[model samples]
Target: MLRRSAYKNLQQRASQLQLKRSASQSVASIYFPSEPTAPVLKTESIPGPKSVELNEELGKVFDNRAAYFVSDYKQSIGNYLSDADGNKLLDVYAQISSIALGYNNPELLKTAKSDEMASAIINRPALACFPSAEYGQVLKDGILAAAPKGMNKVWTALSGSCANETAYKAAFMYQAQKKRGSLDFTHEELSSVMENKAPGASDSAILSFEKGFHGRLFGSLSTTRSKAIHKLDIPAFPWPAAPFPKLKYPLDNHKHENHAEEDRCLGELEKIIKNHPTDIAALIVEPVQSEGGDNHATPYFFQGVRDICTKYEILMIVDEVQTGVGASGKFWAHEHWNLTTPPDMVTFSKKFQAAGFYFKNPDLQPAQPYRQFNTWCGDPSKALIARTIYQEIEKYDLVNKTQEVGDILYKSLDTLLSKYPTKMKNLRGENFGTFIAWDFTSVLERQEFLDTCRQYGVNIGGCGDSSVRLRPTLAFGEEHAKLFLGIVEEIFLKLYK
Candidate 1:
């Protein structure tokens, strides 16, 4: 019999061989054959002179305060982002997690070039009133096919914030209808609505958790409790926010304590739902709380939330905008919870290239036709692209493969972070695919680390006050993960040690 060390060495070697074998067949390779194998640093600094000049020119007409660099999209490919300076950086941020397949994916370009796409773009239909002949098939074959379990209907919107705001409208309308109970609107109700008063304009609210970020729009901003800057100087709705669990690091080491913390937060949530001044028609929550530090709670906490929503008869919405489309090791992050009842609506946008909410209940559709109406209700071009993305994901099984790659990345990161425990801490998102994040000692440290990362030819992003997050595209594979790990470890050793 071989010794334990020999067996472990053999296992490691086998894993390396497997990774190399899969690299040739990776989705990135299949789609982006011309993708760069490693980052190309041509300039001493990121946002080099050419990028700075272009951005300065762009700033004359547009707000480019937050611009990292002027990107050359034509030159960008696969998991790499190219700047005006002709420097190609390994982009784990992936345009803030929106690129599903990759930059300039051939299949997406094919869809863009098709006659149907050109027609959709040139003669964009006002979808609600003049939906194209292929609209139903488009929904059926694409977005609806990828819907979360127990969801079959979709109300498409223009963006993530729009998707959330529309979902709120649906919830408010559904609840109002239930209260109306077959009665027609009274003259007083009709007249009061013009004044934006009660009995017409709803006093109902949407409940979200602390450290949660829904969006920056008027209605969604009320539910967005992530940052003061986003909400400052904006008139926000008087909505309620409940506590989200503050789980400890290395979750396995603090299981009992974390459970207690989650329960406490759940209790507070129940109290808020029962006692808020306004009716909470719906409660929206992010699975990983992306913008708010990537906070995570166990399935127990989510299941508890599901139970609470059921008891209160309030709609439960899962905001999968950042965690959706196979990034979380599942098509939807809520799929990890295995809730007894599915979320009332699941909102998606970022990666899918289309924004919408998925629901099963017919009641969610407003009683009046134009109640949910708008010009250009949804973009057909985006829908066509979403269809291609769905087909590709299904054909390639990217979700499961993402999980395998994430497992390897997370374990390697865990080992790396252990060497600098104080410098980096609270690593989270285990078993949640590539949807991973961790915190630094302070906000400055995190920012410096991000700046250092970009300087090293790897573009990453930060979330919340003091956390670094990895929002790699679904096309990311073991090869990409290894490169990323190596870069990060090198940076950590140089800076922290």
Candidate 2:
């Protein structure tokens, strides 16, 4: 019935569809040959009897109040997470965005079982005092290999909080050394330091933006301005907080307004820096404020901040704890900014399985030894895991793959969200790989949505007040995205229809 040309066009279209399907299957199978084709729901609810019982038992010895369900790590694979209830859910949260690779990745399993890993875990040298000879090669192959542009050195730490805290220490020390300038410590400085006074302790502060979430440690907590629940009764420093831009969504529609908002925020930041009582040694910021909210600003905004920091001689620290390791379409989220120079220090953790700050300035390191000393400088075991993660990411070209999947996912979400503008709004992370999010109309609605998602076998997570974020693993393919989108549509229909 069709003309020859039309028939040929149909055939070509069929061939292209087949190729796409085959590519999706190939990538998924390469990472997880045994991965489930779709999520398997076995329980009536997420914490069905078995999970509830296990959580109750876990609570006896640990704080299980936050446990969504008792995870069965052994049965989890690829983009799926298994629970004690024998339900397999698609895990977009990815252990709070820490799991770089999918669950029980064979390569990671092999690394875990290797003799070198075993030796590093059991013989665990105090890295600072006596690092193993292999540590250098391990770092070179893994962490250093993935260092952001203009960064060649690293100071490994224990966690995200520790990384930021250590970077703060470096900033303060660097600033103090510059002030001291070839002069040895005075007797007054030495005596005042013991009393925790200004001459020795220094009155420098680290400035952070409002709604920023750095960490919970003493120094880092002082800079955290996210939630009161996290800070509570704890003592905090008097560091000033600067306002971050609150840009409107559908960025294209509000380009002029967004640009104006950013300029206002930049102006406010400069004013804060100028008026702060103590010298602001550093300014720590997240590329995308994850915990505070999945807030974002344009490259122009970040460039402005960079210029201001340079002009003020204050160190700029980019906290990439949740936005690093290929989730942001780039290895480092700040790469999107394309500033004239890189941040003075970039801190990373979560997905990398290791925590540290990368710096190019050697002066960031203390002039005297033992000044930055710790018992275990960093764990070689985590470094080994980080190496495997980096190797696997490179071997699979996962960053580009994630970017491809994110493009498809973002487009799909844009179309889906158009019909439910009242129920959901402020869709973000358009080209930011899989680090996307959308906000619900109310906190209760968001909670219901998250709860309903689990009821349908999807383990999702929320941030800020009422935002759902997608933090899927690098192995999350087009197939996973398709399945997730379908599940989300079903949930939306059931809730809003």
Candidate 3:
């Protein structure tokens, strides 16, 4: 057995590697301290008395049926979520994969407490019309600093749906400009558009893949095919949906079959672009389809899609909302694709705190202002937090660290997967940092498993169909990985025997 010194050495190394500030430095740590070295379970069931009471009170005024438990953000710490009942759980879901650098990070707290952040929060600006004094520099230092290669300009939005919806607008406007070719809009065109008619409204569509998700807004909901609940009641536009590949795993074990499957999907994608009922304005896809079961595609598959979109003059939009900001090993997951030409637009949110779309074509900007206008275009407060988050990520090289931890997690998970093959299968995200997931036999089984994880003091989450996804914070290091694996091993044993 490894000696106690082994663990000591690990912690010692962690201290040495942590930010190197003087002991007397007045700056407070941005994130909360790592605590509950192991998860602390107090009750037989989650949502124990305190949580149930809070939810019941909340239900009197709002929807609380979906409430998992009442969270106590103040008590939560790195990779652990604290509930009102005082249960601190190893949190892998990480607020539906949004939290980066973990809760209450020291650097983030400092940035939050800074004069700059306070000003931005109290006196927010309409970024597009009257950007603040620090707006230009703030963007250059933060979001743009980590932008996917070849993207320079960014248009901030409110959420993932807004980002995607705006990107679709940009694509439609850009495509119209390319077709219009210096011609002024006719009087009939302008008036007809107000009535939502053909000529001025442009009858163009954004092409999305099957089993994909963009958002819940009208334009974006049409592109979202992951679930019916998010779209069932909403009146949707008739946008074209292309088939995405369904590859067999382990990928290496079924190489040729997977390649053939990708090719088949590519064929369908090309056909959809060429023969869609409406002109295809853009083709949007997730680098790793997060809401659609952590589905992944190969570089070859993406390149093929890019080629098809180019050939058909359809703009390519990579929806990196959940796959951006270093969660997927690289800063942007599409960075792993190595396309010969960059995507037309990249929509982002989740980990960045700030939400927006990056573009190279200035034509994507509407010919007139207020066409893509909103009250608060995007929050500068979130942008300030994003800047701090980006800087801290660089300071600690947290992306690379997450990637290293992911490798360890993957290997251990493979052993667990083997032990309970019937309970789980198609394990993925091997080299893609800590953005990992696996499939259960059924949706019920998967839901039960998540509940079981909660009983064991691990707040895990499920995704598209029957997948148990791992979307831990970037600060989920080797120690967290080991603890997670220990619980998982125990759960699998209990599940099987």
Candidate 4:
């Protein structure tokens, strides 16, 4: 017998499925039954009338420059995001890759309306101190269920940067504690620490790779080397930096050169760790550099880095903030590495809806109370939502489904790329799920392409200087992929001709 989804796909071959269609149809069928059939452009520009009016009103109190257009969340469904301008566009970026289940999913709406959700929202707890009685169950059912392999302990935080910062804190403290042999803080050390000085304030640094984008907070920002603009006004830690390998495109075609480049970067990493003046307490890296134009390094490079960290007695932190929760077709992208031992800590946020670090080292926990403490350690409401997301992913086998759909989508995009060689180059993320991207010749062309996609009723995104990245939700399937490729092809056809 054919699989359930295969049957569903076969049934959908009839015609374009409506938003309020049967449940056995594509995800779009159930989630957005009333969703707009296609793009409806009523104005000359996207930020037409209603969007401009709303932005003008909001500008009085907030920064509205970055507002692309006022989105109509209620009208958005499945893979399509709606703007106040009444344009229903296929959304591949998915709210900067934070959206997991797609726009205003019916299941999420149901969860939001539940009594548990209501109480959690109205009576938000200071999780560390007064966690709800159902906290353990919520965790076990949600975030814990999808914890990185070999990690049993978790420390929750507020955001991606906060998660990375907390993990860095844990690493620094763990290293210092190991060096101290005891927690006996000297008066001078305490006094020095009060003024942000060494010994107590931490002489250790979080070693980060160039082109890795961790976050914009102080500690995480120090680790973020992707863009200078994000770091221009921020004060960053004086930390040791390592080179992340710049792999060539059509990865299989340039295997030898890519392997050599990885080795070169590995050598640089070792040199940074061994020769840097400050001690390397921990090294943080992304499994795939999502914001750095979706740059990828081979498993061999990661393995070598792991070995180096082990030798140096430094902790390894896998920043899965943008890569975790089935984005790369793995529960955790590091699973693809096949490491003998798990990394010291794995920091996560974005798709998980909750933010935290997963760690196995008990000693990594500070010996003293109030060390890892924060006012609101985490949000129980998000944890509840995360729990539901986890359940739905399992029920639908979304990750595996994403893998299959990604293969189809990647092949399709590769074909489109071939047709426009001058506009598209360095196509990447072949087997790495739908976490794909391609570089344009110039930043202006890249920006224009994104704007044009909006006109064609597709909401896409860009990263680095001149690269378009695909960060569609796990729910994004063959149908959505076909729509995306159609729009992309139309644009390329218009531009190239």
Candidate 5:
């Protein structure tokens, strides 16, 4: 009934669709052949029986108040997280965005079971003083291989907080050393340091942006301006907090307004730097402000900040704790900024497993040994895991795949969220791979949405006051995205229809 050309066109279209579907399935299948095609909800409710009982038991020995459900890590596969009650939910939170590849990935499992990993775990050396011979090769192959442009050296640490705190220490030491150039410590300086006073204990501060979440350690907590709950009753330094731009969503529609907002924030930042009582040693910022609310700014805004920091001679530290390891459609989220020069120090931890700050400036290291000393400088076991993660990511071209999946997911979300503007708004992370978010109308509305997501076998997470953030693993393919979107739409229909 059709002309030859029309029939050919139809055939071509069908073939393309089949190819897309095949590609989507193949990526996930390559990593997790046994991965469930859809969420398997065995219990009538999440935490049905076993999970609730386990949580109650766990509460006696540990703080289980925040336990969504007792996760069965052994049963989890690919993007699906299994709860104690045998409920397999497609997990987009991905252990607060820490899981880079997937749950129980075979490659990671093999790495874990290897003799090298076992030796590192059992014979864990105090890395700074007595690092194993293989340590250098391990770092070279893994962390160093993935370092951002212009960074060649790394100072490893224990956690995200430790990474930022150490970077802060480096900044302060570097500034002080520059000030005390070619001069040995004065007697006054020596005596004053013991008393935690000026000259020895530098008065310089690390500046952070408002609504930015750095970490919870003492020094890092002082820079963290996210939530009061994390800082209550803790003694914090009097560090200046500058405003971060509050850009409006649908970025294309509000280009002028967003640009103006960024300029205003940058101006305020310079003013704060100029007026702060103490010298500002460093300014640490998150590329996306994950915990604070997944806040984002344009490349122009970041370039402005970089220029200001350079002019002021203050160190610029980019905290990529949550936004690193290919989640942002780039290895490092700041790569999107295309800055004239890389940040002075870039801290990473969440997805990489190994926590540290990378730098090109050898001067950042203290002139004297034991000045930056720690017992276990960094764990080799974690480094081994990191090596495996990097190898797998590169082997599969997972970053590109993540970008492809995120493009499809973002487009689908844009279309779906457009119909429910009253219930949700401020959709963000457009081109950012699986790093998407949307804000609900109210805190209660957000809570209900998150609760409903779990009810429908989707383990999601929230940030800031009322924002749902998607932090799926790198293995999260188009199939996972489609499943997640369908569940989200089902939740919307049930709640808003």
Candidate 6:
């Protein structure tokens, strides 16, 4: 009888222990775990032997000159990137600012393995011609759900360049349609377009800023003025490049001068619009000029552009390909501007995975079909991924978290950079989430700093000549920020000493 009583008591304790274990494993706990305690440097040098060998082999068939190292993505977890050489890096670049969540996110993996995902991937739908029945529901639940304020529609495309190009097409067509009110295309117009001439082929131009980088395609490349290499040898459109405001840093100190500078640029922009020979259909600008060295302008400056565009009846296209999807403390970076009138169109890609333009006006869609048609209009698989990303972001409240973490990172860098003014200057993107950057005195210094950072197991990236830009994932937290800061400070000290 005593043995039976003891057995019953043991069974009750085991059941209690099982219940405790189940309670501890909540859904949230399964998703975001603590990041690596510190970076692990397994290789003496980055792009170690294995990486070099793979790149050497890859170069035989493809251009691998720009590859930092071939990544072992399967081994990469969270904010860490694993290279072919088995080096795990604290990745701040986040696949050139494309990764919304950290690597191998559990939620994303679950989505990836779903039956819906399998269908989308294997039977990729040509969205415009023969869209799948489920396409609308997918977009509605995913992409459209995360639309910027006032944006009601999106036209999906393949990449950032393609998204911008499509927006340009929409702009050109809209202007043409407006001009040809209640009119049909003439035989001359039809024939001339076939020959790639004016009247049928657009003589209208898209205006971009001096340091703006749009894309590498023919039309988009014309608007991309960041680097000569991106534009060289390609015949460009007769587009005008306006001056972007070059504001002084520590903005409070030089408020008057910066304000005057913005005025000067705004004045020049209007002058260019009035004087340009071709009709200025639209003007494209970045909230933060990313590739053009992380150049930034004030909300006042962006607002001025909006006012000018409004006055001229020109469309304003905010290119948020690099800055969108919660990176800049907002779903869309342009939201920070709080424009009196919403932009005519906004182009996006990178972090969103699905590339496209968002607009409120139905007029942006062409009057007839085939005008904006393409094969496999967009990958539905990517849309599925985008959907998962957006849902996870909303569920986790990552945008606000990014803002909180970004503030800590910016302040930490501000303190660190103060000690090495010459080595790092123009620390920008304060309060702009994890999208921060600082200018090095020279290209060599910048490269050296990046190389040294990598040696210390942090994979950062550079932009627009001599600037180090941080593009950490939305998952990058206070712990990750502290780790990054400590590594950077160590590098800076070693370099200076």
Taken over the whole model, the C-alpha lDDT of each candidate is 0.89, 0.89, 0.85, 0.83, 0.89, 0.87
lDDT of 1 by residue, 1-497 (tens): 11234224323543554434234557887887677666777777888999999999999999999999999999999888999999888899998899998899999999999999999999999999899999899989999999999989999999999999999999999999999999999898899999999899999999999999999899999999998999999998999999999999899999999999999999999999878988889999999999998999999999999999999999999999999999999999999999998899999999999999999999999878999979987799999999999998998899998898899889999999999987889999899999899999999999989988887778999999899999888898887888778778767876877
Number of clashing pairs, model 3? 11
Give the TM-score comparing model 3 with the true structure, all chains together: 0.93
Q: Is 2 or 3 the stronger prediction by lDDT?
A: 2
TM-scores of the candidates are: 0.95, 0.95, 0.93, 0.94, 0.95, 0.94
lDDT score of model 6?
0.87
Backbone Cα, N, C clashes tallied per candidate = 0, 0, 11, 3, 0, 0
What count of clashes does model 4 give? Answer: 3
Per-residue lDDT tens digits for candidate 3, residues 1-497, read: 22334334334543544423232211112243335456767666787889999999999999878889999998887677999989788899999999998876777888989999999999988877788988888999998897889989999999999999989988888888888889988898999999999798889988899889999988999999998888887898888888888988999999999899999999988777767777888999999888888898899999999998889888999999999998888989998899999999999999999999999888899898888888789999988888888998897787887788889999899987988787789999999998899999999999878887887788999889999999999887666777678777766766678
Where does model 5 exceed 4 Å of error? 1-26
The better candidate by lDDT, 3 or 6, is 6
Off by over 4 Å in 6: 1-35
Which digits, one per residue and each the tens of the lDDT, describe model 2 over residues 1-497?
A: 11234224323433444424344453657767777665667665677899999999989999879889999999998888999978888899999999989999888899999999999999989898899999999999999999999999999999999999999999999999999999998999999999999789989999999999999999999988888999999998999899999989899999999999999999999999999888999999999999988999899999999999999999999999999999988989999999999999999999999999999999999999888768887789999999999998998888988988899899999999989999999999988999999999999999999998887778999999889999999988877787778768867887899
lDDT of 6 by residue, 345-402 (tens): 9999999889999999999999899998799877899899999999989887889889
Candidate 4, poorest ten consecutive residues by summed lDDT: 1-10
- In model 4, the Cα lDDT at residue 367 comes to 90
lDDT of 5 at 448: 92
Model 4 lDDT tens row, 126-240: 8777889998988988999888889998998999999999999999889888888965988888999999887668778899988889999888999999899889988878997
> How large is the C-alpha RMSD of every model relative to the true structure?
5.8, 6.3, 4.9, 5.2, 6.3, 9.2
